[model samples]
Target: MIIPAIDLIGGKVVRLFQGDYAQKTEYSASPQDRFDLYVSEGARYLHLVDLDGARDPAARQLETIASLIKNTPVPVEIGGGIRSRKDVEDLLNIGADRVVIGSCAVKNPTEVKEWFRDYGASHIVLALDINIDPVSGKRFIAVKGWQENSGVTIEDLIADYREAGLRYVLCTDISKDGTLKGTNVALYTDLHREFPDISFIASGGIGSLDDVRNTAQSGAFGVVLGRALLEGKFTVKEALECWPNA
Candidate 1:
């Protein structure tokens, strides 16, 4: 499956580099316009990220998110500032197919595990944002859009989520996100090899159709496309051509 992103901030559809609002690219004034375009482009699964809302408190895009869920035809998997049971339940109630928890999961595994116990596996996804230490060969899960490092190891984090009974992983390499440099292909492949039983959703640095087909072979269930599609590096129809419809 192919997943398209609809990242929102301040009621507009925008994207930031490595999660920095200063580096944002204003695609559309309203997120609803982008949502409509993604649907018309043949997207079945919508990846919605509340960039500012997820990284900070006082970030409430629920009204906008709810509107998207209410108005759109496709199923949504939303993330960003999803912390408590109420948050997850509210989104699901508003028709979010899944809720992605990031910083909270790294900071509080016990709580995330509790969430899995109550909400079950399909309802929750562990969004792991990895930042590779260039010289040390260590990967730390970045929180707040790489502003703060959680210092959590990939092995330990993935293992903890797996132990908690969650089988889905949304892995993104922050450094490659929106750079159009190509994805961290080997990282996805390594994680896939390590956890063959889990389904991984590959994000960040999807530039060309070849990248899509190549990464799909790395055991990713789906891929998320952003700047490449938006900048006209390629079209959604071209990317969809790489996948056989179910």
Candidate 2:
């Protein structure tokens, strides 16, 4: 499935190159307009990231996010600066289909695990942003809006959540993110092989329909469309066509 993404900073639709806030590119289109367009094009799910919230929990744009979530017809999964149980509950209460936990999942596994057990696996998504070592080629988790390295490998963290009833994992390769070069097919393929039961959503570096095709072929349950869609590199409908029976 093609899940359209909207990264917001100050309630404006934006994209950060390699997760760097300083290198952000704000789009002309409004978030509501983009959401309407994507839904009209048959998007099954929508992904939202509160960029301001990511930098600081106190600065979260709850009103804007709540408005978007309340109005969205399809399932919406939101992430960024989701640190506490109240954060998860508030999003869910506002009609968020799933709450994505990134840094907290890596930093506080025990608390997040309890959330999984309490809220059920289907409602929580682990946003495991990966930063690969240049020399060692080891994939480590990048947290705090990709600002801090948790020093925890993707394999190790997922293993910790395996018994916690982890269902959805949104993995983004930091090097490949926002580059429009291509996705890391080998990485996703390896992940699928390692954890066949988990539904891995492939993110980052989606430049064309072929990228979407390759990601789906890599066994990704879904692909998140961001800059590519906003820049008109490909439409949501065109992306969906790339997936078999999507």
Candidate 3:
């Protein structure tokens, strides 16, 4: 599915350049307003991220999340500041279709695995944000809202979750995110080949319809349109038409 992303910072819709908080640009429209627009344009899924919650799981933007959920008709998968079972339950109770676990997945695999088992893989997503070392060309996972490195390799985490029966994964290359450059198609292709059983959704650095086409051709389960969609690089309708099965 061509998932639309609504990133929340201070209860307002915003997009950060390369995951830098200081480099963010705020959109005047409310989250509800954007969600309504996307829904009208044939959006089947929404990728909602709580920036505040990501900085500190204790500071989840529940009110904002609730408002978006109440206003939109489509299924919403939420991420950021989701650390415990209660956090997951609260979101699911409030109508979140799926809860994304990031930092905690790396910090406490055992707890997260239990959550995956209890909640079922279909209701959970493993948000793996990573950055590739320029010189070495090795990928390392990032945590704490992509501010800190977890020292864990992306491959290792994927392997860790494979045993837990993880069904969905949202992989974002921090360097490519919000840049409007293009997606890392080669990376996603390799991932699809490595984990043929998992559904991998590509995020970050998508600037055009061609990027979306490339992802669909790369065997990705879906693609998250962020800056490209917000900047009018392409419309949600066009995206849907390009990948009807997305």
Candidate maximizing TM-score: 2
* Candidate closest to the true structure, highest lDDT: 2
Clash statistics: count for each candidate: 2, 0, 1
Clashing pairs in 2: none
For model 2, give the 10-residue run with minimal summed lDDT. Answer: 142-151
lDDT of 2 by residue, 162-239 (tens): 999898999999889999999999999999999999899999999999999999899988889899999999899999
lDDT of 1 by residue, 1-246 (tens): 788887887887777887777888887446777778778888888889887667664676878889989999989999888888788887888788999998889887888899899888988888889989889978899876578988887778888778778788898998888888789888888888988888889899888888887787777878888777677777677788886551
**TM-scores, all models, native as reference:** 0.93, 0.97, 0.96
Residue 170 in candidate 1, Cα distance off native in Å = 0.9
RMSD to truth, every model = 1.7, 1.1, 1.3
| Model 3 regions lying over 4 Å from their true place | none
Candidate 3, residues 1-246, lDDT tens digits: the string is: 899998998999998888788898999888888899999998989999998987877788998798789888889999888989999998999999999988889999999999888989899999899999889888899987788989898889999889999999999998888888889998889999998998999999999888898888888899999888888998999998888465
Q: Runs in model 1 with CA error above 4 Å?
A: 55-57, 244-246
Q: In order, what lDDT does every prediction score? A: 0.82, 0.91, 0.89
